[model samples]
Target: MDVYYFTEFPYAEFPESEAEKFPSMRLTFPNTYFDPNKAHDLFKRYLDEYQHAEDVGFDGLMINEHHNTPSCMDVEVNITGGILARTTSKAKILMLGNMLPTSDNPPRLAEEIAMLDVISGGRIVSGFVRGIGIESWANNTNPVYNRERFEECHDLIIKAWTTPGPFRWEGKHYQYRAVNPWMLPIQKPHPPVWVPGTGSPETVEWAAKNRYTYAAFLTPLDVAQGLFARYREYAAADGWEAAPDNFAFMVCCHVNDTEEKAQEAGKAFLWRMNHPLRGPREYWSPPGYTSRAGAAAVAQRRPTPLNELSYEELQSRYHLVVGNPDSVTRQLRHIKDTLGVGALLLEAQGGPLSHHDTMRSLELMGREVIPALKD
Candidate 1:
């Protein structure tokens, strides 16, 4: 399995009690708690960690973006991607990824990603996502148009990358008279496109139809299994076969020298499962952001929120893997064998996880856990 390093770049400088003052920690949570100098330091440290992960032998480094929350400091994945492209040499840069629905400029998005692929010497995995419901509120984008915009924006970006330019693009949501980009990806026909989903049938079908990788993010093993099975079924019906490379899994993970030490550090993951995942239902599932079937599937996907699950419960259900090298490797291997995923997107840096702890964990994964998983 290809192990990828990931982090939300969380800012936990403020007291947790402050989040109680708001209905949700997303969208409406005030940024009064933010401090620029601290965030500047964090950005430096986080980028350093990415570089270190590459040096330590991770196969890929994944970056994501979000708005109006301390949950994810990366407000723009492409910006971070550019930084990684220049800084790192070997690891694939997986931006999971551009929020197509919320973007107003598809051509610019295409140009940016193409530039990243070129800068990275073609080691870029382009991921596309329809931003979550809170993104609708954060960007003031109409939720009803979320899927439509996502599809149209995606089409335009792909065309921008693959089709010969200086052409006209007239779509429902985006239009360009001259679709020529000075920059093009080095990868023939464009870089790989991976889509992450969490119990969204439409997403599975869409990704299958286009032969894109479908990554299941933080879903239960059983739920993710069902989702991938659906994707495979779609591929079969289309008279194609889906390989392990067509699937990936994202989960919170950490490792240390000993099980005891690892358990102590693993407590830090609770901070992420807590406030970042906590909020009013409206904040998470705003009207029209998801199709009815998708919404229903989501409701049944997880019996309880990760926030409500105890640490042991989280590990038991495969939502997280926290242990020494041997145990974490065991758990991750089970996930790989159970789901047939080719890549594991490990959120090794999570809420309040100390820098010292994170670096040590990365070191251990590089020296032991990652190699064990490969075996």
Candidate 2:
């Protein structure tokens, strides 16, 4: 199993009457806070912590991309990439990817990533994501066309990385005079590509068809297993014997001497992290957001806006693992045994856990859980 320490770099602020509030703790609340000065130092800590993950023996360190949100730091992948290049060695740097269709120029992404690959001495696990929900609105894209745009963007970027340079290229979403990337990746052909998904049928099918490794983003284990099973079935039918080694699953985790202590810590952090007393009552849906199926499914359960969905609802809808190291390990082992997933994306960030608490969870996993899993 490939162990990874992932960070969300959640924003934090102190209140006179209460503990510091973690911004990325809940999806129900609208981000109504900001401070430019605190951001710099907070980001530095985030980087330090990420580097520490490598020192502690995680096989991989991960960074993701997002924009116009206080939920996560380092909106630009290049900045994160540069920090990782100077920080550590050995651990694969997984940029769970930049949103391709939303990007105006895919070549720029290809070039920058290739450069990072070269600088990192070939430690790059490139992830490709089609921007999610409101991201389409944020990027001024039509969500309906996101899948199509993603496919075209992927093709164009690949050609740019491999083909001889300065070749004219024209595509629906992008047009370029030169088909060559300025910087070629250190890894032959390209860095291994991982695709993160939210259980979309087309995405599952596509990942299987292309033989790309798929990482289940935030779905529950049972659901994740079901989705992987579907992917496995597709792979098998196409003449590939799929095994547990074919997929990756993600889970939120915490650890302590006892389950109660861990739960208390997790709950306390979540409570402190809850920014709003109630949920947002807005469309929250950005234009061109293409989660018609997801939306319909939620509607069947209870008609409500995105922001209004209750905390319990979110947990039920998405399988989020929250428990001590042993409990977490058991759940993961169950997933591996039943679902046949080979790797895990351990989300070092829970909805509202502090840096101290997050590190504790990570350390416990490294010291106790990982060894057991390996056995």
Count clashes in each candidate, considering only residues at least 3 apart in sequence or on different chains: 0, 4
* TM-score of candidate 1 to 2 decimals: 0.99
Using all chains and alpha carbons, the TM-scores for the candidates as numbered come to 0.99, 0.85
Tell me the tens digit of each residue's lDDT in model 2 across 112-207.
889999999999888898865546655768776888889998888778777778888788778887667779999988888788876576788888
- The candidate that wins on TM-score is 1
Question: Which ranges of candidate 1 are over 4 A from the true structure?
Answer: none
Q: Model 2 Cα displacement at 110 (Å)?
A: 0.5
Clash-forming residue pairs, model 1: none
Which digits, one per residue and each the tens of the lDDT, describe model 1 over residues 171-214? 88988899999899999899999999988889999999999999
Q: Each prediction's Cα lDDT score?
A: 0.92, 0.70
